[model samples]
Target: MRSRHPLRIAAAALLAFATALPLAATAQAAQPTAAAGGVLYKKINSGVSPSWYTPEFERRLLASGTDGVRLPADATLPGGVTAPQAAGLVQPGIRPGQWLLTLLGSDGSDNLLGWCSANFVFKKNSTWGLGTAGHCGVVGQPVSAYVVPPPASGKLPGLYVIGKISLSRDHGIGDDFAMITISPEFSSWMNPTMPVWGGPAGVHTGDQVGEPLKHFGHGTLIGTGGTPRVGAALRWDIENGAGYSWAGAATPGDSGSGVLTLSGQAAGDLTHIVADVEGNMIGVAGTRMTKILQVAQGWTLVNGSLLPL
Candidate 1:
């Protein structure tokens, strides 16, 4: 008989932060208005049900960050891929677990493929970037921040092209991540803080079963309203370099969310959901940070503040 439960990688749905010190919770604002800044309008099917990818839903996804841009040398790019034309200014205070990233199709079409949560901020020398699941897109696929929601005016919001998939490893459980090189035009909006929790004080190496894990994701299904999820590591797969947790389960559209230990150490990236043959949800699994850092050599996690641009 087939195993009762099977592990499934949480695919992008087309659809945060902190370690120990508790920061005062900030009220998550709804979608940004044209008055907030100019909105980019586009026409494309977002793969899934259009109703599910609405503005209210995007608001539930949470909005953060400021506006600015600057290109950096040493930025990684897939051969022959060039950055898309930059659009709307990124909101101030942009941080992980905040913006919903919509991945455009790789076939040179305008189709809105799917989306995933932004995980951590990283810097390789002077270049800054964002992290998510490798399965989100292939190398050189264009990516944009899902900022403005679908408006009543009936025009679909245009994308704020941020960068392209610079590096990715969708091999399997212990190795699922992608790095996006932020276009210099949108670089200054980067923030290293996790939303609710704080430090990610540093990178965590091994597993600590029973230790609580904290996550802040914007998956469309859960509608968290910008709140963080709390759960504990239930087990570890040493061979795969992955950890499983029961509570604080990750849902579809939550792929690539960052996971941190209670004390704020960066743990790993949530890659998939564990479920049973009956289709009952079990828990969530993530690649350990130890493995991610090892595979993503040369890139270092940015903790508190970003170095001067």
Candidate 2:
């Protein structure tokens, strides 16, 4: 007979070992899988928290090795990514509901990843933070105030290094939201509600079916009504726990925005848009902010406390 191939023999032995191993051992050997494109991706059992939840965010703050927790408030391209100096848009005073933007990818080939609205602002001890959809920016990514876009380039001004992202997770794909600690320099602009869009009525939880809903982003309002569909849309092996809008829908660049009831209670954050036609999109999807905060153990709302569901 021909000499047995070494590779075949090795494969046979490995298969035998695997077959003989106890089932529990095999299960224990499994690890969380990573996502593509290096956005700190992972897949977990449905409804379970992502790997970078409470502990990871806490550890990140400590890793900074600073007297106080902070993020880059001004533009300084990482990894030597070159872009034009940002033209200043921030003025003497800043307030909630104002637009914010993030530059995605390296400087020269940068994309206007996000041109969204700030949902809320919060403070803990002396630290200030802002809340937006997790999909807008990842943890430790730089953020800046909004400027006009499409070929979104040149030295945009009002350039201040916003604080680094402390915590963020995407809906469906991972966890669906993020919170950025505000740099003290920009803290003056912070507020609890979107005054420009509606009111400072404050945020609350649970579905507001038959209640009117409004989203403030892209410097305008998108309205929705009819019985809100609770937990209607799920994707990427994760349940959105989102209340779907029957009327208006969100489009690109609306991620991380809050879908607020007219009374000012935060219903959820815009995670994805289901359908669209000629500036009219339907079936807007978002993750419940209350549920997000419940899982976000170390985080609280801008009221300096967590809201009840």
Candidate 3:
């Protein structure tokens, strides 16, 4: 069992909107299950509210540690293992649309601060990184993934430390995004293609109102059952670089999940659940890819095998 620590950070203001409604960060835990081949994997189902939700929210730390069960020394690597593998053995890769856990600090404790879905894979110079919501973590917070890669050999899936939140911002709408600098060991396993929905042909800019959008997120509360959602862009605030879409519904833990155009162009990332004055969920809102690229400067979107748009 991994040792647990008390999360020390206080909740921060989630957004700057004036709607007088509860603007919750769609970041929470989901149920864990055993993977195929008897590979023991666990989802940090700890019900801790993300630190960016509200001022009065208190942290609910997980009773058990959140570390993944380690793979054995003799375990076989997954197929298609890339070069420069760790420990002279190839391992499965981490890809977009996977579940990620945000730890409190750099000490590697199993104390889960929060969890969110990964968006896209990025490359800045030679460094690789994963994209998530800015509210998912603050700068310097450690990150991990509860990966369940395809069953290969008899090796099981478990938790792994991918990287840390090197850049983050949540200045209200259109500015909620973060970048996790991927560790060298996991770089070879990085896959740019989003699970299920393929091709994010490239970074999509400009307005796309009324256009069909596709999203694959892991919000446990949204009840997606691991299936992608399709909806239309409700509106686009071009000047502010935010957009709202009715892609079914984006709930807690869905923040940072990427959205793409039907033609497979990377559109944006889910940031918050839009609500009305009475706190009724209206739609899901996110920062546009154009804005993310603009703010996350120097980082280029890594392209994957293109699929028919």
Candidate 4:
């Protein structure tokens, strides 16, 4: 059999999602238009249909009974090999906040392939995990995140590690989202809470046009507002995919960044891909967290702990 390109796989998966509209809830949509401040908004419906994952495949995967979804043995993941961790003793930190994850290549070298974010941190059955964009890693790719270097002493720089990606939904498989299962030993370092502007109780459906959206991302390790309120409401580009667009062009490492409402509700995850015009990214789109948690069985969307904004 011939190998398929990742883009091709993503396109196929999107097509499948588009065809499965009836499976999704009916959402009121608004007309797509170019708005001020470079924000454009759109909405889409949900669906059920026959695609890559047949009724049987979906049945078994969802029935796996694990804390995470389990794929069949034959299911192919990108980067068939894992990225090797850097040699020598290193103290990397894990936290439930915006993160930058580096995707490794099969050669165990930094191919500089994918860069994304760990949107949030959550615990299931006492296990800690980080959520991110699915395209960021292969099934078992060696992923890394920023960690506070030693010392309850003076604050120092951050560190990185071989944090592995366990569960994922490739664009070709489901939506573009994945869960990075952190080791239970690293529980002290992770927090699933978020900055509160209001009640971000749990996963809620998306908003309509003119609704304001703020995306949290690592812009620069500098500046007071470096990582908050990064985007404006756009539109939902995909029909049943539950995809939403927003103003702002996402940089190379911006994928998987978490988008939220000013009220602190979860919005969606930043996709690695964006709509560009003459090399300028006009807007970015992502799979709604509501839809992701719904479709990706066993994945929980919870408000870890309430924190004031």
Candidate 5:
């Protein structure tokens, strides 16, 4: 496997995503474009520096339960193992958001992978859902939000393995991504919660590579402090075409967070894998408020303003 930085992952993914959109969606797509990074909270430790690595490296970011970032400039992930194979396998803690979700049964039991988590779309009537990496949520399985915590908290921040998970018809492995459909029941759990502190982070789209953007989320599972919508925020002009910031990319635990820009504008949600942060890359952004509208059971313009989904 070839190694990749998070930035490269985001860029490469976009290339594939554009090429593989469902025929219906592809018809609506504007065209292939360029982009860059920035995300929520702190970056996850991942234990490995390179967000993406080669199978031959063997120096994975985790020891078990989900370790390692997968990427390379020209090769697919999990294809490298050159790292000190044995030494790179250290167990990392499972935090929601970044942890890959898995489901075992539909008994409504917490049978999903402890490492999985989700970023849901809160809605009324409890019919909310979210979009996540395709590999995690598939046809007939449950989605995992957070692994069983150390038991110290007795509570995790994501959904439990209670029901079925649905993916977007556009999902693709060759694209290395997926969209997750959740239930409104899962939205209730994240009520009155914004995950990180500061302000009501929002999401916006139709942005140019040079347009300004901001992000917010827990620094990966590594435990880091979050920054408010203040200070000299990084610009979204680093990569190409149109891009976000690299330093602000989300970490392991920030999978489903939103990426809103200042001025209460929706830039895009921290949806997919943002690129170029710590290690190989960082931010892996996906859809923002615009897409959120697609799955949002309902919508309301709070204070005459569209809230970031």
Candidate 6:
């Protein structure tokens, strides 16, 4: 079981934005009868609520931490996995249209693991259409990926998959990381209209320090994300580092989770989604929404579901 290129995993909009700012940059899978990645990687802690937390986001917390919360794990490498991959482990508090990520193995060979949350969407019939960096979907390239659905969710059940990604270009996978549509039958257990963190739709997605954020998972209660409200796209010293957060902080297993406002509004997906999946923050993952939809393998938010727009 190999994982997606660790080196390439860090290739996304975060890198491009970080480069422009003269700041540094940042940074799944599964089994069904078996443990696909997302099932095992559960959020153990509670996301901290930043003062900047907006009502818009707090709404997302509506059903967070209830039951069925788990994180997806990647089976590519030798446990060289994403710490935040656990988001899928615990049942999310929200519904469909929630964001989800499928962590793959090192070599992109199989449907090993995955991670997902309220802000993401889990699609079906994606054998020919798995998830990949938005940039991975080139105009003329043949992009085939992997997918795996999560086990039956007692509460907010849904489909999941570990994506085996293949990119046609280097940066194509970035900005436009892509995920195809899922079938409604497999997407039954979970809803498609609730706030991922308990917030409403079309909430603020961009913000800076002193802002509020929160993470809700399984590892620890209040033992999760949502910290001091760090700056958005902070162009820091590449020499010292970039986007280093003293605030808007996070803990392990909080990776790939969306950062919401205290109001429960969906703010932005955490970058590199990991604080230290390895040990340091130098190499983490970041999700680029704007670019994610620009790819040939389009993405859409339909009736709260993220499908091929």
lDDT tens readout by residue for model 4, 1-309: 999654334434433432333211212222332233343322111111112324454343334321223233343212221112211112333433444444343232424434455676655676766787776676786555544433452334332442567777755212777787765545555545543322235764756654556555432111111234444565654545467765543433445666666566777777633322222334457778776776556767657444632
Tens-digit lDDT string for candidate 3 (36-108): 2222112222234333323221122121123344433343222222212322112245766766668763233
**For this target, which candidate reaches the highest lDDT against the unseen true structure?**
3
| TM-score winner between candidates 1 and 4 | 1
Candidate 1: give its CA RMSD in angstroms. 15.9
Off by over 4 Å in 3: 1-92, 105-112, 148-155, 223-225, 242-244, 307-309
Q: Which run of 10 residues does model 1 get worst, by summed lDDT? A: 36-45
lDDT of 5 by residue, 224-283 (tens): 222222111234432231333422334343434444444545443442333322223332
The superposed Cα distance between candidate 6 and the true structure at residue 188, in angstroms, equals: 2.9
After superposition, the stretches of candidate 6 with alpha carbons farther than 4 Å from their true spots are 1-118, 122-176, 193-196, 203-208, 216-246, 249-253, 273-285, 295-298, 302-309
Q: What does candidate 1's lDDT look like per residue over 16-49, in tens digits?
A: 1211111111111112111101221111111332
**Candidate 2, 226-309: lDDT as tens digits:** 111122222222244433432333333345556555555666666544322221222345566666676455666654112211
Query: Any runs in candidate 2 off by more than 4 Å, and if so which?
Result: 1-95, 109-112, 147-159, 219-246, 276-281, 303-309
Clashes of each: 27, 29, 2, 18, 75, 130
Per-residue alpha-carbon lDDT of candidate 6 for residues 208-242, written as tens digits (9 for 90 to 100)? 53343443321112122222122233322111221
Which model is ahead, 5 or 6, in terms of lDDT? Answer: 5
Model 3's TM-score against the true structure: 0.67
Q: What is the model-wide C-alpha lDDT for candidate 1?
A: 0.54
Worst 10 residues of 6 by lDDT: 26-35
Task: List the candidate numbers ranked by lDDT, top first.
Answer: 3, 1, 4, 2, 5, 6
